[model samples]
Target: MSHKIIRSLLEGRLKAWAAARSPALRIAYQNVVFSPAASETYLRAFLLPAGTNSNDLAGAHRLYTGLFQITIVAPAGGGTGAAESLADELAALFPLYDRLTKTGFSVQVMTPVEPGPEQQGDTAFALPVSFQYRADTT
Candidate 1:
């Protein structure tokens, strides 16, 4: 239950940010059906929940941690400048120590956003950006 709430809160933030952009970027959410146009730039969001554990012997407190990753997909041969700029914006969106709270649950961004190596395929370049998050419950 807590995991679902955490995911919702985090994903909500990302969705809102994307929607508010000047030229909204299409997003492929987990398990959602989405097909971008051939030359379009978009984003893919993933929530990788590590697991939840009791914070104490009493089991009254719990801790949840996970990695949230977003991949920026751009047209091949378009150069990396656009992808890199988007990565920078995403990193700023979820800065270290940021906190998200809803319905009495709170999640914190535990690390700086990190960008992974770019992967080039026949049709697109995929740049992955990710960060760690932690949530605590009583």
Candidate 2:
């Protein structure tokens, strides 16, 4: 099977998660999933498909581990706190390295990485958090 389906599933879960956060956070990132055509003035949160690693977990079935990157881009001025808050939410949601059981995948690990600026300009500031998820490609 294609890993794209797995990535798609993970992205949907992340957006659902953003919506379920504290009221302020939920509203701050109301449009949690990225829309390429949206205006630049709004805070944008989205997932990037970083690819995956695979291995045979059992006979005839392979376990695929996906590498997903989450980026929270906020306007340059007060975006730092918003970015950090979202990062915290992601970190909390994954909790070290575990599965999303109900969602059908096991998270091998999720960590806040690229501690430096991914992109910076007059209107945006970004933070990237990386995650690994493993699932059977039966």
Q: Estimate each model's TM-score.
A: 0.97, 0.62
For model 2, residues 1-138, the per-residue Cα lDDT tens digits are 445565556555676776565542321332455453232332343344354444555565665654666666666777477678767776776665554543464435444333335677676777776665566554
lDDT of 1 by residue, 40-114 (tens): 999999999997899788899889999999999999999999999999999899989999999778999999999
The most accurate candidate by TM-score is 1
lDDT of 2: 0.55
Candidate 2 to native Cα RMSD, angstroms: 5.1
Q: Give the lowest summed-lDDT range of ten residues in model 2.
A: 36-45
Alpha-carbon local distance difference test for all models? 0.93, 0.55
